[model samples]
Target: MSMTPPPGWYRDPSYPLVERWWDGTAWTDHRRQPGSVPVPLAPPEPAGHGPDRARAVALVAAGAVLVTSIVTGVFVLGRNDDGGGAAAVRTTPPATPSAPSGAAAPTGSSTAAPHSGAASVVVDELNGITLSLPKGWVAPSDVAEDDLVMTTPGTYDCPGDPGLCRHGTVASRTVTANAERSPKALAEQDIDDAANTAYDRDVLGGRPYRGITSHRLLKAGSVAVAGRAGYLVRWRVRTGAGPGGYVESLAFASSVGSESPVIVRLAFDAGAEGPPLTDMDRITEGIRPTGDTDTGGGVGSSIGPSR
Candidate 1:
């Protein structure tokens, strides 16, 4: 006695701001803003069996509520599709189950499948750069307020307290507030802020990792990133609560010809539960300019470990 919703637009299960096509039997790829015209479904076959059509429509409608609830809850953790300019360092926990606030949602699906091989590039059009997303890492789910943030699969309870935490995160964006043009100087200057943002406290005033107590420089020197000259500073920091982690600040010139300095911050918790530390070097070496493939100066050199 159940009825299926006919072929029409329904509220998108993944994002609440828009609607997606729900075909006579299942969901379709078509999506549009709330009030925009819906994409027309394909023409029906010539006078198909009346019972078959009716059955299909019934199935679609019958499962509509269940599918919507499941999909919405699964992808509700950390979804932010806002396209904004550079801002101060802000580390917030994974968004709550409620729909995240932002401008227009992204046009494509919100699934955060892991990338590999040639398709592993994570393009950050906002910063005009791209980085190779490692095998276990997925695209940004708005874990932090950076232009782009690629993180490991899921989150866990922070050892410091009861909040959720991601063991690994790599964030990138252009440096608009600072006037420094030297990559080395910028990298050194930003390391402290990076450590604090990642470990000290979140925007909600929660001390997830408690706070950074001390840090030791692990690496500092010139290098190349995104086809531009850059410098990186890595530190092994100790936190007041949980096992501390590694933080790296890399500064380079933008490949978009604006010469604006770009910064990439990396944070990885130390322990077996966290991602492999080697991922740091791999990610740094995989950065490339988004569009132009001129290979400005090859991969160039890398920063060596220091005391």
Candidate 2:
């Protein structure tokens, strides 16, 4: 520890233009510049002086302690060579927090881009899928297995609701990287599943009309989606009361980039046998990945589920 100066006035070593009070161990904020009249902290007690002089010295010492204790703040604006030359003041810098080492910054694009499907009639920006759904079709909330559900508004004869139904639903759930099936096999399997009663009961939830009477794979062929060779199969399904219903279904299978090989099934059946879908060609032809970058993929699905 350095030697403590006696508690008294001394010229400040750092600033030659001023004198400061050394409170022994530390430098006090009390300061004075040259050519200024100095205030004697303790006036000399005349030989005849007694209790009165001693009391005055005590009051002066107490005042100095009060001034130093109150000034805890730092960096009070000081007048340099200009005029506002106030006394010396103590100041300290504020502390701030910082990030720790080796932390990775946040990222935006974590999902793989689709190799094709950029030209679809509509696009689901989040899942990198494009669609050519019918007009008045709206995507609903609560999508399962990342599937896209499109619902078209219309009137239909239904068992549950008391009024005419105005909702026709279709879904396409793409399974990527299924090692158990090739593209052709995947397409065939999906088409076959579409024809089954289970797919109707579970997927349809008895919407529009129920009671599937028949389902069959109508055609299977090789096609290209996003410049990648894939297989497509058309399925014909029949549902409802007597002869029930009939609708065409399509399934596609292909590899999605470095990800696993993917197979997609897009199906529609309007409770009853719905007529041939008018927007099918545009949607299928427009299938391409929305490229590697995306802008704003917000809440809600593009097309809603069967309502």
- In the range 209-273, model 2's lDDT, one tens digit per residue, is 35456666455566555445556666556655323332323334332434334434454444343
| C-alpha positional error of residue 177 in candidate 1 after TM-score superposition, expressed in Å | 1.4
lDDT (C-alpha) at residue 299 in model 1: 61
Q: Say what the RMSD of model 2 is.
A: 32.3
What does the lDDT read for residue 35 in candidate 2?
26
Quantify all predictions' global Cα lDDT against the true fold: 0.60, 0.36
Taking all chains together, each candidate's TM-score versus the true structure is: 0.62, 0.42
lDDT (Cα) of model 1? 0.60
- Winning model by lDDT: 1
User: Tens digits of per-residue lDDT for model 1 on 1-307?
Assistant: 3344466666555443335555555544343333433322222222245565544421123323321111111011112223212642323233312232222323334322233422465676656676776667765542323344567654444656434566778877667666789999988988877787678765445576777889998988888787678888999989888788898888888767586887888988887866788888888888877666565432635565575
